[model samples]
Target chain A: MHELTVDLGDRSYPIYIGEHLLGESRWLQPHIPGKQVCIVTNETIAPLYLSRLKASLDGYQIHTVILPDGESFKTLEVVNRIFDGLLESRHNRTTTLIALGGGVVGDMTGFAAACYQRGVGFIQVPTTLLAMVDSSVGGKTGVNHPLGKNMIGAFYQPYCVLADMTLLGSLPPRELSAGIAEIIKYGLISDYPFFEWLEQNVDRLLVGDQEALAYAVERSCRNKAEVVAADEHEGGIRAILNFGHTFGHAIETAQGYGNWLHGEAVAAGMVMAADLSWRRGDISADELARVRDLLVRARLPVTAPDDMTPARFVELMGVDKKVLDGRLRLVLLEAMGNAVVTSDIDTDLLAETFAACR
Target chain B: MHELTVDLGDRSYPIYIGEHLLGESRWLQPHIPGKQVCIVTNETIAPLYLSRLKASLDGYQIHTVILPDGESFKTLEVVNRIFDGLLESRHNRTTTLIALGGGVVGDMTGFAAACYQRGVGFIQVPTTLLAMVDSSVGGKTGVNHPLGKNMIGAFYQPYCVLADMTLLGSLPPRELSAGIAEIIKYGLISDYPFFEWLEQNVDRLLVGDQEALAYAVERSCRNKAEVVAADEHEGGIRAILNFGHTFGHAIETAQGYGNWLHGEAVAAGMVMAADLSWRRGDISADELARVRDLLVRARLPVTAPDDMTPARFVELMGVDKKVLDGRLRLVLLEAMGNAVVTSDIDTDLLAETFAACR
Candidate 1:
């Protein structure tokens, strides 16, 4: 097992990445300070991993809230079920909530932990590659509103994140591709060497090679942990981590969530961002092409939904959280391995990129 | 006018106590860093002070979400209205949320702000004495659940708290009494001198003496601020601040909320706590009598509702946020002026106090 710490000072926690780490009491027990444990998993995951996890938590007073699986279920109302189970089971403030599913389950469970009795201990045991590489590492936990994705949430850190690569053996092909989108994001944002490595080993990740998957997860977490530690609240440098997210959120909001996977929309959104960067004379056409090529090789979408228009995208993006003082702050590439968050977007260029990408 | 700071390190904010501070832009504008402002108030408060508060932000883009007035409306569904309004108006992450009512409005707005786009700027403009002296000053913000009172919330601080004493001119007598319950709590928990002062000036406060009310508000805020600063997340000493809350929450939950005003429930709960303290030999019967006498003088309840039984109270209190590992941690008065949180409660004595108080 490989251990990486997201150093957030007093709120710092560890991310354990390796094969067959789940069902190990050693990895899960140390973080749970109290005797009561509430494991929140989705219906799909419960059928597969719940019993194994429950077995690991042998002595504790255990409770489980199994939710229906999907991005559509990521709402305040759905998250309330976890709250309902918690209150019904009489889970106390000291009780630790274990989020044992994909990103949706983790987000809702982490958010439930955040608001449950004004914060409690949370452990993220991410099951999907998407969660292992992205959502589970950062403290961004929340639900979606009809108006926007992650519109209601909190920057609440978890006690620890346990990412067992063996869990990915059962992931659907599309979900695996979706996870690679975020993996590619880490390379594009700040790590040039990792970006180059991904170019050579993108095939290895696509085929579910455990070694490559572990390396990508660990590297992505390391990059994310650094950004989060420096700016836990997204005050400055952290906004760069949202590279492609502003456009991706608009796509997700426009397509009605669940319809388009977050990473798929982000895959396409990254292309639009790169195109805009090329138009702004920040990066070469070759670099923009290379960005799209990596995502294409990983079998992720490279364009917005055919029905979405530039006007619709603009309207939906207006309500995105990234907008500040009525200006849309787009995270664009200054270079292949660099990202910059700027509100000063050339309207003509944005329209051009939207038209081209769609 | 008096200014007191809730020293929560970087998240610290000032509590301004004065006459006519609400209609002034000078106090409101300094805290609002963005151009957009969403004023969240209830129907009763909107008709009264919303316009006055709006008038202060002459140059800013303003929005209002007027909720139905009452504790019954303090829920996730109602709080969603604030989120809907914020998104509908395109209030981004930089926008500030101004809570322009009592504790219900404050709690809902603060929770909305805390969750809106993963936290945003929030300011508390309290109109009720209960809010001004207690809820608004502390960072405890959330909506109540059917299972328990304040079972879901965030410890998110406001940018600043503005308590306009003049706003109290229109407060109902019963509401004023509710506010007094918390002020008396400060005296019993940490400030005996303030407790003694309340004994002499309770009548003046009841009659709306501005000078007496101002002194009480400042003193209560100081006491709360000190506790909150020392332990912001209620680790140890801060639990004492919830001296009457566990018992009080049971009363509120048992009555189905909004029936017994929060302060009234707390008043009765404090009396029961004092009775329990006496039984435990922590305080004298005379001290318990003094506690009851002060609440009665303030026109607050000195006993739990006649309909509630010990078993029901026990059931409700068991689900309270204070419960740790199924153990009920009651904040009992160690003396007239000091409080201690103990899980080692004598159940027999607890039932005796519940029987005696009811």
Candidate 2:
């Protein structure tokens, strides 16, 4: 087992990565301040792991809320089901909520915990790679609005995040590719060597090689934890973490939420951002090719949706959280393994990238 | 204008208590970090003060959401209206949400600010004495759940709280008395001298005498600010600040929210707590009589609804935010000017208080 702490002072918590850590009460119990436990999972995840998670929570009052599975279900109305379950079962201020699914469940449950009784304790037992690597590590918890993705939420950190690697064995192939998209993001934004490492071991990770998967998860979390520690609220350096997210959110918003997975949209978005970066003379054409080829090799999308128009992208991107004071700040790569948030967009270059990427 | 800071470390904000401070942008602009401003006021407040506020915010992008008035509308569905207006208007994270009504609007707006794009800056322009003195200062922001009052919320403070005293001139007599119920709460729970002052001047405040109202608002805010600063999340001593809330919430819940204004419910709830305190031998019969008399003089309810049975009280109180584990922790008077949270109640004594208070 490998462990790393997201150093947030008093709000700091450890992320444990290992095999079959779900049934172990030792990793979860310490963070639960009270005896009442509520497990929030989705229909797909609950049938697979709810009983195991509930078994570990023996001797405590337990409640389970199984929501419909998918990105489209990630809304305030759906999240309210968790609140309904908690209140119906008499979960008090000290009760702890355990999120047991992919990013959707984790996001909704963490957000529910953040709002329940002003704030309560919550632990994250991520069942998917997308969550274990990106969403679960940061304190960003929220639901999607029709207008934008993650537009309604809070930065409420979990007490602990238990990423049991064995759970990934059940993840679908397309979902696995989605998770790798975020892992690749770490390399593009901050760690070039990891990108190189992923280039070499891309096949092994694709086949669910245990050792390769463990390393990817650990490294991704370490990169995320470091960025989050320095800027918990995304005031300065943390904005770099959303390297492809601005363009990706536009794709997600354009395609409708559940149709394109967040990671898949981000996968295509990174390529779009790279195209613009090359046009800005920040990265060479060869470097951009390498970025595209890596995601292509990993079985991820390398182009924006054909149906999405430039005008649509502009309208959607304008409403993204990254937009400040009417200026659209895009996180672009200054060089391979380096990113900067810049509002200095050349409209001609942007139009060309939008035209070319599709 | 009398200004005092609610010292919450870096999250601290000033409460400007005086006559008509809302029209002065100096009291508001410093807290607004961006050009976009959204004023979340109910229909009742918008008709009264929205234009004056809009005039003050001349140079900024402004959007207004006029929620329906009264406590019944304080729900996640209604709060979502604020989110809709924010997203529709493209109010970015830096946009400051100005809550321009009473406690319900403040609670909903603050909660919306806490969740909008994870979090955003907000300023409170509380028009009611209840909001100006108690709810607006404590950083307690949330909407009520069907099962309980304020069962869901966040401890999000505003950048500044502008308590415009002159706005109270337009307040209805019942609502004005409701505000005084909270003012009297500050006196009974923490300030005996203030309690004596209220005893002598309750009539003056009831008649809207500016001097007496300002002094009461200032004193009430001071008591609350001290309690909130010491325990921002209600960890320990802050629970004392919820002196009559447990019983009061039951009454409010029993009456279906809007029927009993929050303060009216609290007024009755305080008498119930005083009754219990006298039975517990924490206060003399004379002191308890004084507590009841002050609320009556202020034209507030001194007893629970006749239709609410003790069984219903137990059911509702069990789901309160103050309940830790399964134990019901009641905030009771330790003396004339001090409060304590205790679970040690003789059922017979509790039954008698529940029976006798009605």
Candidate 3:
């Protein structure tokens, strides 16, 4: 197993990445200090891996809240059901809550732990590649609102994040591609060689290459942990970590969440960002083309849907968290493996970029 | 205006206590830097004070979401409405959320700020006595779940808290008395002299003595701010602030929230706690009498509602945030003003205390 640390002083925790780490009972034992443990999973994941996870949690008083899977159900109403499970089981602030599914389950479960008795213990065992490489490491836990995705949530960190590579073997190709989008994102934001590495291994990753997958997950988490530690609350520099999210979240919002997976939207959003960057003279057309080529090779979308108009994008993007005062701030790539948040885009230029992406 | 800092490093905020604070542009100015503002006030409060609050936020573009007033409406479903208002208004992370009512408003708004776009800026313009002294300062933001009060929420603090004492003049006598319950709590937890001062000036407070009210509000906030700064997440000493809340929340739950005001239920819960303390030999009967007498003198309930059974109390208290694993922990008075949380009372003794109080 490979271990990476998210240095958050007293709240600091480790992320364990490797093959079949889930089968290692040692990983589960240290995090589960109390007798009462509530494992929150989803219907899709529960049948595939619940028994093994439950067996690892043997000798503890366990309760399971198996939610119907999908981004569609990520709402406060669904999160309330988690409160019901904890209360009915008499789970206290000290009780450990284990999130054993994808980003939706991890986000909901982490949020449930954060709000259950003001806050409680949470351990993220991310199953999907999207979660393992992106959402799972950060303490950003929340549910979706109809008006926006991840609109209602908290910056509550987990006790640990266990990303087992064996779990990736069961992920569908479409889902695997979605995860690749985020893995590629890590390269774009902070790491040049990592971006180059992802460019080379894109096909291998899609084909379920264990070595390539493990390296990508570890590198992504390392980058994510550093960024999260530096700016836990997005007061300043942390906004950079949200690379293509402003445009991505708008796409997710415009499509009415669940219609587009977060990573797929993000993949298209990155293209939009690249287009905007190219228009702004921050990146050459070649760099933008390279970004598009890599995403295309990874089986991710490289353009916004035809239906997503510039006006619709503007309307949806206005509600994004990154919008400061009223300006739409976006993370545009300055060069390969580099990005900067710019709110300086001209209206005609932004509309032109949106038009190009569409 | 008297200012008390909650001293939480970078997340610390100032609590301003004075008459007509809501009308003061100075308090609102530094906290609200952005052009967008959302004032969340309930229907009951909006009619009385919304315009005055809006007047203070003059230069900023402000939107209002008037929630139906009641503890029952303090749910995620209701909080979603606030999100709709912000999204509909195109409010972003820079938009400041001003909570303009009592505990419910502060909680929902603070929580909305915490969850809206992962988190945003918020300011508290508390009108009620309960809010001015206790709820607003501690940064405990959340809505009640059907299974538990404040089961869905965050520890997100506001940029500033503006407590306007003058608003108390228009408050109903019962609501005013509810505020006194928390004011008295600060005394019970850490200040014996404050308790004695209340014993002497309870009548002046009930009759609307501004000087007496101001002193109580300032003192209560000071006590609360100190505890919250020391243990922000209730990991240890902070739980002491919830001296009677376990029982109080149970009362709220058993009576179906809004049946008993939070402070009224807490008032009764404090009395029950004192009764339990006396039964546990932590305090003498006279001390217990003094506790109940102060509550009565303040026109607060001093016993559990007759309909509440020991079994019901046990069940409800079991779901309290203070409960560890499955054991019931109660904060009991040890002297005139000092208190300690103990899970050591005999079951028979606890039953006797419940039966006696009921």
Candidate 4:
């Protein structure tokens, strides 16, 4: 197993990545304070892997809460449902919650755990490739509000994360490609060699090559762990990890959530950022084209939908969490595998870039 | 002004207590980061003192959101209204949220500020004595859930607290007595000299004696600030502050939230705890009688309602935030002005204590 510590002092925890790690009860047993465990999952993942997980939790009293799959279900009401289950099952503060699905389950369960009697222990058992490579590792747990995505949440860390690569085999092709967008993001933001490596092995990743997939997940987690360790609360350096998120969040809000997968919106958002970077003379046109080509090869969207206009995009981006003092601070590319936060970009260039994406 | 620090390292903040401090713009102006300010107040306080508070916020863009009075409005829906007001008023991260009312407004606005764009700055302008002496000073911010009270929230601190003693003059007799319950509680749990002083001056506190009220508020705040500084997240020593809260929360939940003031229920709950402690031989009968006499002289409830049965109280207490591993840990008095957390009390004795209270 490849272990990466997300060094957050007392709140720090380990992210274990490898094949067949889920069956190893020793790693999970110590973290769970009691014999009673409640595994939170969804309709899509429960049917496929619930039994295998239950087998691993043999000595403990286990219960399961299966929610419907999708972003729409991530609400305060749904969070209450998890609380009801825990309360009804007589689970106390010592009881542990195990999130056993993708990002939605992990986010919802992590939030539920955070508010359950002020806080409780929770473990991430991410099944989808997107969650395995990104969301599951970070302590950013919350539910989406109608006003904005992740508008209601807390920065509560999980006790541990068990990223079993074997679970990725069950993910749909579209979902797998969506996960690649974030993998590419890690490389684009800080690691040039990883970006070049992805360019060389894009095909192998597409066909479910286990070795390539494992390597990508580990590298992505390592990159994320380092950034999180430096700034657990996005006060400064951590904001850089939000590359494309400003535009990506705007697109998600404008298009309405669940219409486009988060990674898909982010995929197109990255291209917009790259183009804007080139227009500002921060990066060469060649680098922008390379970014677009990579997103295309990964089978992710590279342009915004026609219905999304620049005016709507601007309005939507105004409410983004990263915005400050009415100025839209965006993470723009300095070059391939390099980014910086800047609010000095010309308004005309930004409008043209949004128009081009649409 | 009396200044006390919460001492939470970088998250630490100062609590300023005095009469007419709200008009002192010098203390508040430095914390207001941007040109815009949003003051959140309830109907009762708005009609009386909003203009005076607004006058202090001069030379800046100011807006007001008036909510209905009472605990019923302390919901996530109300928190959303504050968010809507913030968005509609174009308040940004730099905009400061000033909570200008009682406990309900302080809690909901603090929560609203916590969730707006992940978080923003907030200041407490507590009007009621209950809020000034307790809720407003500590950074414990959250709204009540239908299933339980304060089931969903975060421990987000404020920039500063403005506990203006002048506002307490507008409070009703019942509200003033309710605030005294918490004041007496601080004396009961941590300060013996304060307890003796409260016993001698209970009549003066009931008649709205300004010096007695100010002294009580300052001492209670000092005790709470010290506890919060030692255990910000309630990991250990902080649990002692919930002296009567385990049973009081049950009383509040059982009677329904707005029926009795929080301090009244807590007053009755503390009587029961003192009786329990006496029965366990941890405290003398004279000390228990003194506790009841002080609450009674202050015009707070010293007996439980007729509807509350020991079985029902037990059931409700099970869901309290202090429960751990199926055990209900309660803060029981060891002697006058001293307490300890214990789960070893006899069930029969507890039932009898409930019977006696009813």
For candidate 2, please provide the TM-score of chain A on its own. 0.95
Q: Give one digit per residue, the lDDT tens place, for model 2 in A1-358.
A: 8989999999999999988889988889989989899999888998899999988888999998999988889999998899899999989898999999999899999999999999999999999999999888889999988877789999999999999989999999999999999999999999999999999998998999878998999999999999999999999999998888888988887786678888999999999999999999999999999999999999999999888787677677663334534378889999999999888787778878888998
Model 2, stretches more than 4 Å misplaced? A305-326, B305-326
Instruction: Report the first chain's TM-score for all candidates.
Output: 0.95, 0.95, 0.95, 0.95
User: B1-358, model 4: which lDDT tens digit per residue?
Assistant: 7777767888778778777787778778887788888999988889899999898888999989999988878877788788778877767667889999998899888887876766788998889899988887668888876666676677778998887777888899999999999999999899989999998998987887777777888889998888888888888888888888777878888888779889999999999989999999988989999999999999999887888887788777663234534377789998888888887767778877878887
In candidate 4, list every pair of residues with a backbone clash: none
Backbone atom clashes (below 3 Å) for every candidate: 0, 0, 0, 0
Docking class of 4: acceptable
lDDT of 2 by residue, B1-358 (tens): 9889999999988988888787888889888899999999988889889999999998999999999998778999999999999999988878999999988999999999999999999999888888888888889999988877788899999999887888999999999999999899989889999999999999999999987898899999999999998999888999887888889988976887678888999999999999999999999999999999999999999999888777777677663334535377788989999988887776667778888878
Candidate 1: where is the Cα deviation over 4 Å? Answer: A250-256, A304-326, A344-358, B247-256, B279-282, B304-326, B344-358
Error of 3 at A89 (Å): 2.1
- Of the pair 1 and 3, which is ahead by TM-score? 1
For candidate 4, write residues A1-358 as lDDT tens digits.
7888888899889888888877778778878987889899999888898888888887898878999889999987788789878877867667899999999999989988876766788999999889988887768888876655676677889999998888888888999999999999999998989999999998888888878888899999888888888988788778778888878878887777778888998999999988899998988888888889998999999998888888788777763334534477789888877878877767778888989987
The alpha-carbon deviation from the true structure for residue A299 of candidate 4, after best TM-score superposition, in angstroms, is 2.0
- Per-residue lDDT tens digits for candidate 3, residues A1-358, read 8888889998899899888777668897897767899999999998888898888877889999999888889988888888989999878677999999999999999988888887889999999999998788778888877766677788888899888889988999999999999888889888989988877788889889888888899999898888888888888777887777778887877777778888898899888888888888888888788889999999989888888887788776663334534466678788877877767667777878878888
Q: TM-score each candidate.
A: 0.93, 0.94, 0.90, 0.91
Query: Which tens-of-lDDT digit does each residue in B1-358 have in candidate 3?
Result: 8888989999999988888677768888998868999999999999999888878777789899999998879988899899999999878778889998988999999989988888889998888898898888888998877766677778888999887789998899999999999999989988999999999999999999988898899999999898889988787888788888888888887887777888999999898888888887878998889989989998999889888888787776663334544367778888868888777667777778778887
Q: What fraction of correct interface contacts does each candidate retain? A: 0.98, 0.90, 0.90, 0.38
Ten-residue segment with the worst summed lDDT in candidate 1 chain B?
B317-326
